[model samples]
Each structure stands twice: as C-alpha cells, then as structure tokens.
Target: MAELPKSVSIREVGPRDGLQNEDPIPTEAKVRLLDALSRTGVRRIEAVSFVHPRAIPQMADADEVWQRAAKVDGVRYSALVPNSKGAQRALAAGFTEIEVVVSASDTHNRRNVNRGTDESLDDIAELIDLLHQAGATAEVIIATSFGCPYEGDVDPARVAAIVDRAVRDGADRVAFGDTTGMGTPRRVRGLITAVRDRDADIPVLLHFHNTRGTALANLLTALELGVTEFDASVGGLGGCPYAPGASGNLATEEAVHMLHDMGIDTDIDLDALIEVAELAEELTGRRLPSGVLRAGPRTRLTASSG
Candidate 1:
C-alpha cells in the first residue's frame, strides 16, 4: 500500500464547472449559491467562467455574477477563461487567478473550441503569457485526459506532452480533467507517472467525474501518488456539454466525508458542505447525484434498543 497524504486541497468548482452545464438561473441565485459555498470552509473556489455568451449561454452573466458575489476574506476565488478575450474579461473583472482549458483529444478539442489540439495549445501558450504579464496566475486544465467519448482510451504520452508544453509556456499549474469520467485506477496512475517523469516539479490537480463510479477510486490512486490537489463540485453538479448522459463531478461532501474518516485533513466542515449541496439541488430544481446527500456520512450512527 502507498503512503496516504497527510492532507489535501480541494478546489470547489461547482459555481463554475458545475453550473456551466445547468440551465441559466437568476443572477441572484448564482450569488446566493456562491455565498453559501464561501461559508463552507473551502479555501479555494472556481467562481465563474468568462466565455462567449453564445458558446456557454448559462454563464452569460459571468460578469454580473462575479461583481455581485460577496467576496470572502481568506478565500481564494478564481475563474475560467476560454481564450485571450475571456482572459481579458476576467482580468478586467479584477480576477487574479484564472484557468484556461485545452483538450488532449483532437476530436474533443475541435468540438470544444472549434480548433485543432495544436492550435488550442498555441492559444494557451499565448494566454499564459498574457496572464503572467498582467500579474495574474494561469492554470491550464487539460480536458479529456483520461479518455474521450468520441475517441476512446487517450494515450498517456499525449497528455504528458501537453503538460510539458503548458509548463514550458509558463503555466502556474496544470490540472488533468477526466472530462467524460472514463478514468480508472490504472489509467490514473499511468497518466500521473507520465506527467511526473516529464516535470516532477509541476503542480498537479486532478478533476474527476463519477459517471462510471470510478471518480473516488481514481482519486485514491492519485492520492497514493502524492497528489494533494483535486477539483470537485458541490452536490455533483456538472457534466460535459458534448457528452450526452454523462454524470456530474465528484461531490465535495462525499470527498470530504471519506477524507475525514480516513484521517486525511481537508479543513472543510462536512455538515456545512452538505447544506450547500442541498441548496445547490434546490436551486437547480434537480436531484443531484451525491451519495452523501442521499445517504448521510459514514460517521452518522443510530442508537439501537435492546
């Protein structure tokens, strides 16, 4: 068995990645959700994304939402930017931490940004430089890192090469996204090893989806490999726009519960997180796919009569 990490950092992406696929809710509702999540003791939150209104209509109010959200002290808030234009918008909105995405699969990349994988990488390089020059941090998220719905079983080498290029282009950090939730333990280990071999110093974050019930398992594998950062959603509220019927992200409550029980420190209040998850479900008007939300945490016990 591999040695478990003493603690981990969970970046809550529900406000951005989780809500980007859902129906457009009122701006006030978005602010409410963000405020509720801020009080959950989660140190990092991906607040919003600055994308074209036509591309992701759900996030059309990114500007207003960010401007209205009650900024919390001691909490680091970030947003996603699709290109140079989105990066500029995020910077103008006074965001210092920004994320940009590129897909490992060519087909997925073309479908996501209407550009080939190489072209998207070139764009990412330029975006990273622009963000750095603006005194901002840039994080590159490689979508479809595990497997692509359109193209099954992505090669690990391709993913590592992308990581190499992103680091060379001055990315502050990089995250691997299991976009379609096709990650397994073996694949996760191989991909991490490949990336580590290329640049062990690069900060890595894993984003998993529970589509096939392997998100937690893959997370465990990455944990054993000394990966201490992850991206999860509150109430499991995200899915790929192009992949039909795929599940949302790994639930924050579920991850917190498991980590707490295993003696891993996440510095998150489980009950508070559950409450936020409930609020997310209520706001979306949909039943979220959260195991903890349905079945309470493992620590909950009932007294029995003799």
Candidate 2:
C-alpha cells in the first residue's frame, strides 16, 4: 500500500467556484462568505474570479467583493481568471496568486473558453510572463483532466502533455480539475503517473467533484500517491456551468473530517467550519450536498435509549 501523507493543504473555493454557479448574490453576501471562510483556519482560499460580467454574472462584482472582504493575516488568497484581460483585473485587485484554466479535451476546452485548447495555452504563456513581470505567481488549472462529458475517457498522455507545456511556460503550479466528477482511482493514478514521469517535482493540486460519489475515494487515492493539495468548497457548493450533470465540489468539512480522523493534520477547526457551511447554506437558500454537514462528524455521539 502506498503511504498516505501526514498532512494536507485544502484550498477553499467556496467564495469563487462555489458561488459562480449559483444565482448572483449580493456583494455583501459574497464578502461575508469570504470573511467567514478566512476565519475557518483554512490558509488558502480562491477568493474570487476576474471574468467578464456577461460571462459569469455571479462574479461580476469581484473587485468590490475583494475590496470589502477583510483579509486576515497569514491567509493566502487567489483569484481565477479566463484570459489576459481577466488576469489584468486580478492583478489590479492585488492578488499575488492567480489561476487560469484550460481543458485537456478540445471539445470541452472550446465549450469552456470559446477557443481551442492550444489557443488558450498560447495565451496562458503570455499571461504567465505578464504575471511574472508583476511579481505574481500563476497557477494553471487544467479542467476535464480525467474525462470529458462530451468526449469521454480522456487520454492520460493528453493531460500529461498539457501539464508539461504549462510547467514549461513558467506556471508556478498546476492543478487537475476532475470536471463533471468523472475521475476514478485508475484514471487518477494513470494521469498522475504520466505527469510525474515527465516532471517529478512540480507542485500539483487536485480538484474533485462529488457528482458521482467518488470524490472522497479519488481523494484517498491521490493521498496514497503523495498529493497534498486539494480544492474543495464549503457546503459542497458549485459545479461546472458548461458541463452537464456536473455537481458541487467535494465538501471542505467532509475532507477535513476524514483527514483528521486518519490522524492527518489539516489545522482546521471542524466545528467552526461546519458553522460556516451552515452560513453558506443560509446564504444560498438551498440544501447543500455535504454529508458531514448533514449528518455531522463521526465523533458525534447520540444518547442511547438503553
């Protein structure tokens, strides 16, 4: 059996990816979520995105939201962008760590950015150079890394090629997005192996969705493979807008609960996180899909009727 990591870093995406799919909430609500998440001991959060208002109206007020949200000390925040213009917006908003995305599947890539994957990568190379010049670190997130809803069964070599190119283009880090929750242990292992064969030391983050109930299992497989960073959303919020049947992301509290039970350190307060998840549910006015949030943690004891 492969060894599991002693600790893991969970980046909260509730403020950005989580809300991007929901109806546009008030900017105050967005700021409130950002502030609450920062207090949950999660060191990293994807605070917002810099996309055109017409593209994702939910993220239209990215600037005002980030400006009003209280930036806690010791917490590193990141923003997602779609293109050079979006990157400029994030930089202007003072985000040092920014993320851009491309899909491994050409069909999905076109659906996502309205352009081919190669074209987006070409732009990403220039975007990375621009970010570097501004003393910012660029992280390239490759969506549909496992399987595409339209094409199905993406080749591991294709994903590997994207990783190689992104790293070569000076991306400070890379993440594989399991868009539509199509990842399995076999797929995860194959993809990670292919990427590792080329570059053994580049930092990689995994983003999994719980649409098919395989998110946690996939996470365990990744842990066994020595991946320590992951992206999760509070209250299991958000999914890919263009990918049909894609559900919310893996719940942050659920992942943290499992890690803590296994004696793995995440440095997050489970109780506090649950509280914030409740807040998220209240803000969204809908029931989220987080099992831990619904059923509580495993350690909770009920009064016996004996």
lDDT against the true structure, per candidate, is 0.92, 0.92
lDDT of 2 by residue, 151-183 (tens): 999999998899889999999999999988899
- Give candidate 2 regions above 4 Å deviation: 239-246
Candidate 2 residue-wise lDDT at 280: 93
lDDT for 43 in candidate 2 is 92
Clashing pairs in 2: none
Candidate 1's C-alpha runs over 4 A off are 240-246, 303-306
TM-score to true structure, per model: 0.97, 0.97
What C-alpha lDDT does candidate 1 achieve relative to the native structure? 0.92
Q: Could you give candidate 1's per-residue lDDT for residues 1-306 as a string of tens digits? A: 899999999999999999997888889999999999999899999999999999889899999999999899978999999988999999999999999999999999998778999999999899999999999999999999999989999999999999989999999999999998899999999999999999899999999999889988998999999999999999999865556566779999989988898899988899999999999999999888899998889877767876
